[model samples]
Target: MTTTSYRTAEQIGHTEQGPRPLPALGVQTAASQPSLVDTVLPNGLRVIAVRKESVPMVELRLRIPFAGMDRLHAARAEVLANVLLTGTERRDRAQFDTDLAAVGGDLSSVVDPERLSIGGSALASGMDVLLDVLADALTGAVYRDEEVARESERLVERITMARSQPSVIAREALQKHRYGDHPFTKEMPEAAEIGEVTPEQVRALHKAAVLPRGALLVLVGDIDPDGAVAAVGGALAGWQSDASAVSLPKLPDLTPGDVRLVHRAGAVQSQIRLSAQALPRTDPGYAALQVANLVFGGYFSSRLVENIREDKGYTYGAHSYFEFTKDNATVLVEADTASGVTPAAFWETRYELGRLVLSPPSESEVDNARQYAIGSLLTSTSSQAGLCATLVALGAVGLSYEWLRDQPMRIADVTAEQVAEAAEKHFAPSRFTGIVVGDADVLAPQFRAIGGVVLP
Candidate 1:
């Protein structure tokens, strides 16, 4: 209904329209890459500063490889991240918040089995204060009893809620099935065990996991690169420790095998999680593999989404992508469906997987995916926040902003034949393994008929 308007249709300029076609090729890339200042502090902290000069803000990212010493380390690190910024010897929780607010900044910390990462931003002029506050937290976090108690309880509550989620359940099952006793399996810790962590253990964990030797700090903003790097050296010069920074060893290659059934009795939906070994970003043909994934299922326009969602209505969405760890990479394919249609979705996913190798993508498919991959990379790094985060990953692999800026041209150079080869090598259905989470009585018999299940 129009509400006292001349006419809604007229205002909106209504007209019949048809879908538009994608544009032809263009030499689109980042206009120019940011100039960079890279250096290492005496304390063994690698600082990478990029001169973005777009806005008066600086984004900071610190990556400390927080690999757990053992299974219990994962639980302790969880609690540590939650309470890390809660208080420090120089300031209580409230004071800490006030100081950061003064600098137009906020900081947060999180830890996985691979790394303990701290990220935040501040006004460019207030960069010194930001660094000071970060240094304070690193050097003198108190982990007071009351704050630890409160944050631990909150962590438990959050984890409890997360565990109840079907997606989380599926992921947990997949990790357990894939890596029975691997430290990587500790990515998601048990909530009950996490809640039992004490303040002293958190202190010990901070000491062990947060060493600066070989750690990386990435800063991007409107600033002079040389001065910025030198400033960082002065500010964090004291963040030294005799202990080496934590790092994970290489991940074992994935071997395709039978699907493990994780029966969720009486569930209304099932989540299919499939993964296979993949190439790291540094590997040759990785750019082609990246494009190949996009053509298969990495984007909404890909074959998997076209078949499973738009054409057949098996699920609301389906996607596949690569996950890079510190040591290795894995491709993940996921889709959620009603319990009754679970088998159909599974069949189509496997069929798509097999077809990728048997038939391969067309020239059009390869080009479209390449364009998207390039456009996304350029756009994502176009801002300070984006570039700051990008630098950390790049830094981890001993790459730089120059490499990222050149990636679009590198991607455009990838040919359809290369993508096809990557598909044949990596996308073969026989090269995948996974688990299905649903009602056993309903799904068990169906899965068994398809093969790859042990009879009870």
Candidate 2:
């Protein structure tokens, strides 16, 4: 028997090692794309529809822009979003759940800092019924006091559980540090705050903030474009639009400073978050920055993951990304490592930051990131739910559908230099705010040696 070891091509009798060919570049030209259709109903409601007949199900997303800094109305929006799903005028909670289960459908509502979204999925055969239920819940919810109380208790439980989780605590602290004094940074309402909410307040907020003018209806599935539009338009025709305009508040300035850390005793691992203010979706730099972010830490093969996880084994995983919004944007780097290795992980993170700033990405690196982003977009848009969600989000921020469709091309065209420039501009080490949630006593001296460490 002969024993043989695997060897490189050069050692295996090849004359020489050859460079591989680069991936196919510039496949997507600017001209070949479909545009988004926009229509307005007689009742001042805006409807944006994208017709993709590949799926048997339809996804509908309705968003009403009523988010605010007012503690009272903000709490009301949250309570209303939950209670509306609990029961409606025609069905009790149990009956509602049964009906949805019978049809293999799901309904969800969420209140974020910018808007309240009510969305659901149902088969084409059940579209009319689902639409009717959604309209009834949005336009005629009872907001019963008992339901509110029950949901408030549930929320309190959720908040309590979230506080005990290191990841959640780190995220909340990062948001506070990023948006100090802004509504986005407002502390989570306590149990007492939840108890103070009244049914009347919820009703008032629904009437004022959930109007048709600020609302957008997005439907994607196996349905007729004209008929679906008319159906949704007629259902919401009676709701009044707010004639008085609402504008999003300007983003607060980010004061650049040293690393900030939050200490948590008894935590076996440290959760680190570093972030800086970023550009909104409308910025031309948005596409380039996204490409840069991927190279830095946006994916498994990113620099952060390669250096911090693969090379050094400092943490389980490391990643970074940019969150785009109408009023503000943020870029974040996150990781979790054993308390003993927290300092080493932080130093490696800093090194990656410095290295990316010092040298821009190579053309091949930029192309790979661009291809990944574009491929992701193409794959996600193939789903009815994904397409509908994208349409709704774009409309909510006053962006056209054409813009969404053209995103892949724009991403493909981003140059390597642009990505590097974006990195240098958006990620300045001196401006980063870091939050560490772990055993402070064990990790403090190491953390302080790296830079600034802020205890909770």
Candidate 3:
């Protein structure tokens, strides 16, 4: 064999003096707008269709507000989502799969405290079949006893396993600490609740909660926009109802206080979760706040990551991100570290939060973060699936494609002074409250000495 020569990674990366500087970002070109139709059908469903033409497949997303206040509502909703695609009036379970497989189509259903969402894709030529099946399920799904029982058994097992995970335990503690007794905190039903869910309860919930009114359906693919909307209107004509789907109750504003320590016995690792209320996407200052969040811990190059992961060896990963709910929003910071180093990690996290406000991000730091925010937005929506999902989220909050197309400009306009202002107004260590979950025996003494932490 002939020998081949290659430069080593270190040789390519370094010169006599140092590593090479990265190339500057090129000017961003605006994407051409697609043909679109946004209309409310006679049956009250909002259908948004766009001609992306990037691939020969179509992506679908449907969102229905499905919140409730009853104690067993979560159990019923879980069982309902799991068994939604099992069968309909016209097709049995096998027949449903056969029809979908013939068109290279598949669908999945998932529910949270806010909404019941269904997402799927199919070959462009099979869009009609896909819509027909979806409409059939929405209008006439029969939650047969046997199918409900089987799915409930499987869900019980999954929920049981999930509740045992340290992440899940920490999340439950954080939710309770942040928003106690709110229906929004009922994200996962207890395993025993699943056993009590009956076929009749699932059927009743579908009848009362899965209405067409106030629901949104988004379709994007290689098809005519107007034609797709017309097709959707025709397929879903029979799914009419007078009552609107229920939206989740508004969340209470978070109260900042001492961090609570939750005891997880025998756990070798610990989770640190913190939260603070922030502006919604609709707020004028949201762009500046977004940049500030990026500089703090939103990305790998953030100060929190550099200080804790790169310097202190505290954790393998850390991140900060916005969690949006309807018109409300909050910024959350999360890091997972070893039990032995948990207190140090907590101290560093608060120190960085205060530092972001006191010594605001520099001009270079703001520029890098602004560029990342704009670049990530464009990259995420370049694909048809991503576009469909993004539209669904925007649509849920009374927005549309215009807001998406205009976001890059919004981010580009944010100045360093604006970022500083946002950081000062939002990132104060006193404006946050959360939970530190680990073995109390291991974490108590160190956290007590560190202060501002409530013991078990």
Cα RMSDs, all models: 3.7, 4.0, 2.5
User: Global lDDT of each model?
Assistant: 0.86, 0.76, 0.93
Error of 1 at 27 (Å): 1.8
Clashes of each: 0, 1, 0
Clashing pairs in 1: none
Error of 3 at 115 (Å): 0.4
- Model 1, span 224-311: residue lDDT tens: 8888888888788778887788787667888789888788888999999999999888787899999999988999788999898977
Off by over 4 Å in 1: 1-19, 28-31, 453-456
lDDT of 2 by residue, 139-193 (tens): 7777888998899889778767766778878877777777765676544655467
**Cα distance off (Å), candidate 1, residue 77:** 0.5
Highest lDDT scorer:
3
Q: After superposition, how far is residue 351 of candidate 2 from its true place, in Å?
A: 1.3
Best-matching candidate per TM-score: 3
